[model samples]
Target: MAPATISTPRYLLDQAKRKLTPTPNTIPGMGAVDKRLQEKEWDQFVFAEPPAGSDLKPIMGDSGVPIIGHMIEIFRRGPDYILERYRREGPVYYAESPALSSVLALGPDATQAVFSNRNKDYSQRAWDPVIGPFFEGGLMLLDFEEHMFHRRIMQEAFTRTRLAGYVPHVDSVATKVLANDWVANDPRFLFFPSIKELTLDIASEVFMGHPAGTDKELVTTVNHAFTTTTRAGNAIVRKPVPPLKWWRGIQARKTLENYFLSRIDEKRRSESTDMFSVLCHSADEDGQTFTDAQIVSHMIFLMMAAHDTSTSTMTTMAYHLAANPEWQDRLREESERIGDGPLDIDSLDKLENYDLVINESLRMMTPLPFNFRQAIRDTDLLGYFIPAGTNVVTWPSINHRLPELWTDPEKFDPERFAEPRSEHKKHRYAFAPFGGGAHKCIGMVFGQLEIKTVMHRLLRQYRLELPRPGYQPRYDYGGMPVPIDGMPIVLRPLR
Candidate 1:
């Protein structure tokens, strides 16, 4: 498909690129400023008077409560609050958020404009207000040319051959971790925490190639770091006050930086198949490799994104299987038909039912419910004038549950994604769990492989059941969607 015709944010893009292109000694300190000030600057830029004879539609919505805006409501109600407004207003709705008054673009058309970003009018730095505080200098936070430049160098690590090689490692980690660590016989098992740990261990072993059962303390710290960062991204107290989430997140980032930076010299000299090794060595034709700081920065962001999204997805999938035993039985039957445990890339493709279930689960409980961007220039999104610096958000989480898009939007139905009827394909951005366009997730394939491998082992060994019938997981939208109750499930050995 042809990429959208996008325009670069010339001055700002240059400034961002310079920030990321750090000097050898000064690398650690670059891009460390809290973005609250940047957000205020954007408010001024966005809400300023338009040029003469501007025919743009003035943004409309509740200004929200005083200084805090509508964020409290958004935090309390999650995407439902936004969806309720989208229904009342239209696809192009507006609201005053903590960052500023912005537009919420619903449905496929808005998603395409934002995701396709043909005009290069949107800035990925929109994540800066939240994610940048914890994940600055990461590729996801970079915009346009700078993003593409780093992405090109990083692409060498994720080639088809390299990904194929990683599968065995993923399978190995999944098997060892699940079999050894998850033997709880209690009728009520802590599914979220258990799955989180398992996925983190897998991330550690597969992505970093850490020795099995080694570095327990380091892993624990890393796990804590990820949680702290997630909480920081959604923290109500956005300032770095002591004893607050922001302060905790800073400490965690410091811990993570020291660890990753310390390993750079070692990883660069050594040769291995792990992602760290690949990143350490991989470079572009110009021989441009990620600097030590860049490697550590990217690792912190990517690893957190990798493990947390998977945990949320697996938790939701388990909930669905627990609630609907028929689907669970079908999944078990599908596993049996495929012949045995520890599925690889070749055999995994044959597990059609497994794919169906994963798809439906993602649809029912989308991992990344929403994505945001800031307009870098005056742009028109589906006939609505979005001024420069306006915080524009697209709601894929709620979009997946739109009545117009799905036959029974709220119901769990795997067949919707199967056979001649591929519901997600109905719209280009209809089921964008991993996002769409140029900045779509780079680890998309690797995540799927990891999920399948983990599920393959899990289905062979355990018959999963919720502790109680008719149980529904309550998701906390603080970060990604996670079960607030820890998603209790009972696992009985199928063997």
Candidate 2:
């Protein structure tokens, strides 16, 4: 049975026939958006045309409909919307959505242009309005010198030794939690939420140094806090109005702040191997440690990034393996070759098939789909004039699927990542699921180790298949790309 086929939604196919007349009050609290200006064009959202006397081409495209712009199309249509635009326009184009009017940079060269940012023309400040309120002062939101300063300090926590130390804890958590929380031979196990819970538990142990039993009530609250704060990034109404996503996230941020602040002293005083304790003790070359606020912010961001991203990636891996059973069997055989024992970093490296599958899974459905930045000064991307203050969007999701860069780009063949067909090596930024340049994900190594450990345990324990033959799940990209159906699977024990 084949994975479900991709189809463009009817609305998009029929958009040409629809009336262009604006609808009044389609989205609540959109008074701030320039509805009239939105009628001009998406490129015109920033400017009617390129700056006078600049030879660079003007970004092309309309902002979609007024106020909400392309928000509905983006979330509802998933990557299809972006792919359609990529096909219509070249690498550089314009798009508009609530709170974001920007140029979409596609392909490896465009991604490198923005990420390399040689002249320091781009700033991470663009993330401020999106995730900064909740993840404030976290490493991703810092810019230039300050970013280098904190990244250097934070490097202490993710050192090779620290990562190796964290692996045993990850293995143990995966072994215990999967065995304890999951029931094998079940025909309807919800893979997404189930793995979400499992990864959260893993994070609690490996990142916080707390066993699964550590303050269950507090841990649960913290977990929910991380979730809400992340989901708040997509809130249509950006204000902290009661009962809305933004307000709940603001409240969740407070919950996280108090929880971390209360325990910072203990973490600093203790000799613990968890990330929280490590960050407390990690210092830059000059021996400057993070202040209490910096520690709290970093901890919140790391915890959220660790669990949520791993959950998405692991779920995607499970889906691909389930959909393509041959790959599952191959990976299982590779895992089985390792024999039964406590897995370590060296053992993790031996699973070549797993690495290929993981890379392909990441290419197929990257957990963090978009890399965002703000142009701090006028710049040209591939000769397209991008003015200062323009919000810039680049899609790793799009990059991974560019037909020019990838062979049969949409297919599930993981071998493209293996051997002589090393398609990801096509360009420097050709396959950046972890992002690139100075701000590449610091915990990427740890993240991959955690995923492999949990996944290796599962592959060793059971055969994963979709709930029914040819069953395919639809993804909701509201926050990260997650299966809207929770991705139910039937697990048959290998024994």
Candidate 3:
């Protein structure tokens, strides 16, 4: 499917041409506005001027096509579409699609401005339209004081002591899943789906404290529900009707709620190692604890976040390692030094080479690429005037590959994250795979440990390579950027 022709209606072309006629004002460091911005209609966002008295420049750019906007091009070209626009329109500009219509904020500067949210102008309500129906009560959906309240309670479960406890369970679950499901010497092993299932199993055991293989059918149902609900974020028709993607998502949300609600009472009554029990028994400084409803809501969101991002990260890392066998061998040697045994938190930390590989992979893909926020009050981003009630999106994946930020941004170089180079340190928000500021991912440490442990086991047991001489993964940007082909690879037994 081709992107809608930008040249149409003589009037639009004329107006676009007029806007390009070298205006007096230009963004600092940007000099004159590029003629590229005039390629699309500026009036689509209805920004006739900046607010009454504000000196901020009127937000500029066009809505692609008519109804669907840039949705087709976005799914077709992925991050490249946004990166091209960023170059043409500069940092702050308008973007529209079936899923969302907002100002696209590119680069670390924009990332810091919104995420820092000093004025409290940005609210999490922007996500209500996208993920609110399904993950309504999830932590990311909450804002300001309410968000902080819930986060304070949630913090108890992710403390260093608690994270250390989870490592053994993650390692054990990964070892068992790899032993049973993966066939050594298999020429066409499906890495994406296989890792997805493995991560889901890990979440079940480590998060819900479910024993391996217990309630097998129910776990499978929950897995399907998560996949459906997450995919619904990109549904063209956002309403629930019949068997459409949006409707399926609504049903899946109900399924997830039911699953979590049914298990809450049991978790609350017992003291256990899993996060569910931890949240149930945990209390804030004032001895406050989550109510049953709060526990259920948090669990559903946490469960989805935990497994989904981990699955994506591990899959991307596996693909990169398979493609670059030298890095895989180098990592294997690092893991071999630790040898075969239960990997503790300290041991996991010792794999410095693995750390660089993981950081580089996250920079390349970043499971959660876009963050959404609505302007509660009028706000200015990099001199662009954004009125109240506008949805603002920050694309971190674009910032990751900005040429100014990293050397040879397109190439895969793990060493950039290592010693003398340390490119990721160029900016505070430069390498935010887990996001930044208050709403950053709560389960980040747990997620990283989970990935490292699983990859360590896989490296010990198998040598990874692509099924063909030159295989590149085609990702479906519709959701969390998954490999559409399931990422097949050859799994050669090492020991």
Candidate 4:
């Protein structure tokens, strides 16, 4: 079969060229390339056909009968279904739905090769059809040099000094959001929505430099857009008909673009110190910067990353802490040691127990279970030959739960991360909550600081427990692993 033709939007092509030119003070060993071949290669490689006899795996049930794998079932059953397949069929496996040509990788070495060593080979295009309209020039969709260049420009927004400056902003947002009366003593309060609200507030204050609780409309619009786009990407039917999720996603993208563009001029004129301002004033080696559209698209991507991933991480941590009260007590005791005060950069760093809790939560409930990469060229992974056009996946969710790497693989134990054990050191990619290598999450430190700060304040102010005994969090296997129902918790004032 002939490969699918994907035309680059004129604006994205222009932005790519702008990033190619060298800028002042380009790092000595940056290894910058000023060419379009990489991007061209990506377009060709993503849509190429897989070799004959590369049969996709079938869904197996308890009785061992082959069942049709649907997106709905995958979203509902999540890692369980995939893990079951891995147990039955070795390391590499495949699954197919009408919409996706899916691949699943099950061990540390396999995951490392896909996410770390061979990331350049994968295409973000699978996510692009939905996210591209909203985040046209965002780094996630760009490959190789194009990805590096934009990442360099955005790195200015996350400097240590800038992150330190965000401390008060994060603290203030957490205090205001967690102090709500609705959260008090309510055992059935849905956590996903609540945490989503909190993260949106944090993003406004810390990323955009807006005041907490403001920009509600813009936040709602972008959040809806992200949800709709993600759903469309995983939808089994790929029709362009109106009223479908894909249609709604496209409309949402336009709404976000318009909203972001309207705010750019005001933000630029004020010369604000937030990420939006940094992107506006940032220049490459040639003193070039993103145009208006690029700025809006980038903001959309940054806002989604900042809000959704942080909120999901916080929710997962809450689930595990609520499930095990003894651990919660330990964390609260640690918080008491640090005192019940607003966390600054220095104080946030001191919460070692909280850090372990967060790490364990991430291991069990990885926000992105599998990282996908297309092979840029033919490559070898653990003696298996992977052709240039094939899709490669790294399963962090599966690897994190391996019996060989973790003791009591399914239990909620934070001490495994403490000194002397440090079991995650078994392999380089054994604990990649934020991935590894060149495309490792640049905001990893910032994300960790944000979650730790929130958990510290919550522990000091409230005693939380799960609504019902033996509550198990269900997974949504769409993009990130989100709790199917909002994680419910009852909060009691600590005082």
* Candidate 3 segments whose C-alpha is farther than 4 A from its true place: 1-48
* Candidate 1 local lDDT, 1-495, one digit each (tens): 111222222212122111111112211222432222222221211222234587665443444444766565466557776777677667876565554346788888888889999878998867877777789888788888889988998887778878778778778877887788885557668889998888888788767879656878557888898888877888767688999887889888988898889888888888988888888998888898888889999899888888988888888888888788899888788778766544567777777787888888888877788887888878877766676766788888777878777888888889989767888888887788888888899987777777777887787888888887677777667778778788888888876
TM-score of 2: 0.90
lDDT of 4: 0.69
Question: Which is superior by lDDT, 3 or 4?
Answer: 3
Error of 1 at 50 (Å): 6.2
Candidate 2 regions with alpha-carbon error over 4 angstroms = 1-48
Q: Candidate 2, which ten residues in sequence have the lowest lDDT sum?
A: 1-10
lDDT of each: 0.75, 0.82, 0.82, 0.69
Q: Give the lDDT of residue 151 in candidate 2.
A: 95
- lDDT leader: 3
Q: Using Cα atoms with residue i matched to residue i, what is each candidate's TM-score against the true structure?
A: 0.87, 0.90, 0.91, 0.83
Tens digit of per-residue lDDT, candidate 2, span 279-353: 999998888999999999999999888888889889989988999999999998898889779988989989888
Candidate 3: count of backbone clashes, pairs at least 3 residues apart or interchain = 0
- TM-score of predicted structure 1: 0.87
In candidate 3, list every pair of residues with a backbone clash.
none
Cα RMSD (Å) between model 2 and the true structure? 7.8
Using TM-score as the measure, the top candidate is 3
2 or 4, which is superior by lDDT?
2
The ten-residue window of minimal lDDT in model 1 covers: 13-22
- Model 3: how large is the Cα RMSD against the reference? 6.7
